[model samples]
Target chain A: MNREHDREIVRYRAPTRINHWIVAISFVLAALSGLALFHPALFPLASLFGGGPWTRILHPFIGVVMVVAFVLLAARMWRDNRIDARDRAWLRNVGDVIHNREENLPEVGRFNGGQKLLFWVLVTCVLVLLLSGLVIWRAYFSQWFPIGAIRLSAVAHALFGLILVCSIIVHIYAAIWVKGSLRAMTEGKVSYGWAWRHHRAWFREVVSARRRAD
Target chain B: MALQSLDIVRRSATTTPAPQARGAHSGQVAKLIDVTKCIGCKACQVACMEWNDLRDEVGHCSGHFDNPPDLGGQSWTIMKFAEHEHADGSLEWLIRKDGCMHCADPGCLKACPSPGAIVQYANGIVDFHEENCIGCGYCVTGCPFDVPRISKHDRKAYKCTLCSDRVAVGQEPACVKTCPTGAIVFGSKEDMHEHAAERIEDLKSRGYANAGLYDPAGVGGTHVMYVLHHADQPELYSGLPKNPVISPFVSLWKGAAKPLGLLAIAATAFAGFLHYIGIGPNRTDEHDEREAEREAQRLRAEEHP
Candidate 1:
């Protein structure tokens, strides 16, 4: 534990931490249900929840919960997700990210351009899924609406789902691409060297803290 | 009588002023196709190929009007046949015109890494610009309708622009113009919504209880809406999934993992800045030296005082 103190420790607030886990758990449930519905070959995946009947019953409910939880998450992070001049520059030189040339890129603050863009994209996708899902919901809205409206909603929902999945794949690959990144979410801290190598500006703040303490 | 005629002319002029009309004319108008009214005529397909100067012999078949099976670089849209058994045990053939949905929150737009390639027009039509496209196939993977087709020649993506050129000139799409049945409706989104509602009510009165309008708030609500005959199981005819979801794993990757990774990078960079300024974790000896020097300076100042 003392060794952990010797290392840099950047902690997320309790709310932020809890919100992340909520999203993580909900996402896993949603992905399994979605896979079962997307193709018959993946129908066996329904067994993860129980069987086809249970999967069908649980899918929409889980989706609703995900949308609600994500909306709350979006509300809290909206300010940080906004694009700024630095973010624009970062996007312009996004090649630096793929090449692992972080030293050449501009010093990023809290969230980088990639992170901000992902946040907004996810938020937009969730909103679309929620609305489209509700419109085409057979048990719920089909009784009140017309067939034409329901068909259109189904198309919109499917399109958004595909886009959201692709964007998320990129998001995952980027996380694994960068070293010491998974630790921030898992252990809630990064090493002193990891901090210095990646976030020089923030590393200075921590060093200043030690100086003030001394 | 002359005063009344002059008042009528003034009312007409005010109501249909050129500036307001021009403002309304400046965007692409989408068409919602009603499958029940279609007769499987391939006139629109031929017109699209001719207008786009696409080759005709690409997906030609023998003794069949269905030229192409699906949308491709050359084929923007096609009419698909859905055969089903009615409650009375008779066979019913439903022909649907399949094309781009032009979703409000288009997946192609989100997945497109290239700027100015896949964009949503002001009128909610998702338009493609080939010049900026990287041919990444991301849009192809992301589109739920499988609308975008990569050109074998140039390797860029192409899809229905909702006839953006024709719509700009206040004309309906070729498919709508050639429809033998009044199945395809082209107009403003609001007008179509009202028309779709009335059509659904008419169908409901005829005992099509499952009939409902399809744009249900998904992907921010699609510009195109559909009126289906089999409202209970429209997916059987529409090629649409009953329950669609944006996989939650995607949310975790975008919302949690990626941002946390970036934060870790920022933290490491901040540590490096400290090291460069000689106050980093690696400079404990230097920090002690600085402290001793500061104490000596304090003693000298005290002695002088």
Candidate 2:
């Protein structure tokens, strides 16, 4: 029988875990508010955020919060996301992914190719949204900026919104498509078998800890 | 002599054979509407609703015959009326028909996660397949024009099919058919462009100097073009984007992240391959194991010595 004292090593500290949840929750809020502002028919969805005017008022603020939270998360995990030479070779054989032949593919450590790409894409999108949103924000910055700048910001905001939506769609699909991925975010843990199969390097680290304790 | 030579070079450059029209290869019939001529009767809206068999019960039917405030499950097309007072004290009305622009670089097509749910038909029309849609609403967010609408009942995204079934059989869209003012023209984009230019010139000669065609070279140029009479601003009219662009941030993200992601995967795989070939750096765990073995051997040697 497993003893209470014989737990595995911590993969993420409590602060790191909490920061992740903040970004995740804020992202959902921003996405929902964004969709409401995107169309008139969807304007009714603003009621979810207290109504149309409130939704509009709160959208940029929510975006700001999301950006701040994501920036913190990014700083903490930036090193893990850096691309290495081995990653290039893994990409060349990405076709194996389409066939569910990852067994023959490389064993990744903490984060895989898909996760790293998502991390960086989210970073770029959030940055663009925040900057452009500031430039075009009528309630706040329109008085301070030139007309041309405001116009350009409006265009940029729309464009970034489109890109972020697309990327998030792909991100969500990948999470759902891969069976055990959502559990990592939701429960903050994955099953032993799932970790061993998908992230074998990390799994080995955990196993070695067990042996040392024994 | 220098100015003359420059003029000659410019003339030659301008006269060079223009590249064959891009949309021509797609076999899609493009539609361009001259909004300057549209009287905003909304006959096209009625015709679209009837043709598509959309109902009035879905808050789509605006009283007084406007029958739809915006694009929704029951409405494929809408006519927005923008009225402004001219400097001369007379009121001018600019009417625009709102629907899918059927852009060459369709964001909806790019954004859809479910394959085959949203597709660009060979004819250049963006088509939707209900069977393949997971109803995730990605297309709703992807569209720059805010064209697609999702139904709460089934969660499926819907939008103008650009009358694909009718166009396939070589017929005009229902709205174009019902337009009495010849404002909504249905023809090749090239022909529509020429017609719109002539109409704009005619309106200008007749004293509407503000009259011009609205076709910005963005979204790779929308197939639907508009000619507006009000010279003030196009944004006052509904369904007109003040500024539209494929966000550079998206381009940068796609450019940088996609390659880096592939690289990360490749590196991980190469590490695995190295392990297989026995040339890799000792696996981290294996290195620890080797270190432990070395310490044990040293302890034995010390005892023997």
Candidate 3:
């Protein structure tokens, strides 16, 4: 109990956890409605959102909510997610990390290299999706653009949406793969042992702060 | 639609083939417009409005012979009037009937995301089932000739159907029936082509050397075609693209992108499942706690020393 890593430690604040869940919930909704409009085979999914018309009506608005929520979440965590030379070294040992050979890897900080990469990829995908979404948003903005541009934007929107969906799947899988990680977002805390094993540098920073407080 | 017109060969946003045990016995129908003989009277336009039971308000004119200005929810068809000057300084009024072409490969149907919203009959008339239309306006982008306007009232797409309703009843479209100059003709597509050939010959004899047919094959040819006196200059009449095809982007969007994008998403999810099976969960065990305590001790000693 004398060791800081032997006890519980706060990983996320309540506001951040709430914001993350908002982004997650909104993203699932937007993706479902978007996929409904993406292909005819998935058209049946539109019924989940009240039908095709409602899916079309609510998809962009849902996307906006997710984007707005993610912006806040990303802003709150971006400094910790910044990749450095140490992150590159951790990336080189990704196979070992996957095999549970944490001893062979460099000390991970707040986020691993994979997490940082996914974060940046998500940022790019969201930016593209929002812009292209505006260009093809039929009820409103599409009328302002030319047919050629609208057609192109529709294609771009689908492409980036696929990337976003895939990235999120990986994001969720990563959270599940690392035990005790889900609690960080769900309960706003993590076992200090889990933090020290996965994010040793960050665990040390937290301990140094605790020392300063004392 | 009438029961007789139930032979939908292709439906929008549908992957499976349509039921085609019969139908298509009448061959494909077509409407031919001879631009040289069009007097810009707009009688066909009025007839379309009367037959369709739509009345676009008499909007203010923009100093052109074209009135009710452009096609809209109520106006399915319109006469586009263009003033032209020949190289020899001869003025000719080029009048064109502008509406849906009823493309053999309808782009609106191809791009539509709502099942049964847009359909193509076996006889080649592309029709919109407004009841099923979600009105995302994808058809407007899908069109090669830029037809298919959405109604502000109900947010459903509207365009000329080549008057499939009248054709099903064995009658000509109201526009074709009302043309005063014998300029607008309707028949089987083959007969219309033969008629256009004879008209082209007559125009060539009268010194319009460029007179030809405007049945562009880029969209697999359209059910509605034009016999333009200056066929070489189709753009002179309006912004008619010389060679219109479904935009490459639309093809990519609704075509390969669909199955491939879905596949990529599924593969990502499946990969996660496989990873779970391969590595199991990375749990923080008692050994991990001991390791963390050792590291904390090392950190404390480094700080104190």
The CA lDDT of each predicted structure is: 0.62, 0.64, 0.88
DockQ for each candidate? 0.02, 0.04, 0.72
List each model's interface RMSD: 17.7, 14.4, 1.4
Give the per-residue lDDT digits (tens) of candidate 2, residues A1-214. Answer: 3632222234465677789889878878887787654432344566799754466568788888889998998998888787665555556677665445566768776677767777788888888888878875555565477545544565566556766766766666556555667656655555444555566665555554422210
Give me the overall lDDT of model 2: 0.64
| Docking model 3 quality class | medium
What TM-score would every model get versus the actual structure? 0.48, 0.52, 0.96
Off by over 4 Å in 2: A1-214, B1-28, B56-67, B85-90, B249-260, B275-305
Superposed model 1: Cα runs more than 4 Å off: A1-214, B1-28, B60-66, B86-88, B243-264, B275-305
Could you give the candidate ranking by DockQ, starting with the highest?
Answer: 3, 2, 1
Query: Which tens-of-lDDT digit does each residue in A22-83 have in candidate 3?
Result: 99999999999999999898999999999988888899999999999999999987987888
Fnat per model, in the order shown: 0.00, 0.00, 0.77
Which wins on DockQ, candidate 1 or candidate 3? 3
| Best of the candidates, DockQ | 3
Q: Candidate 1 residues A45-70, lDDT tens each?
A: 77898864466558778988888888
Evaluated with TM-score, which candidate comes out highest? 3
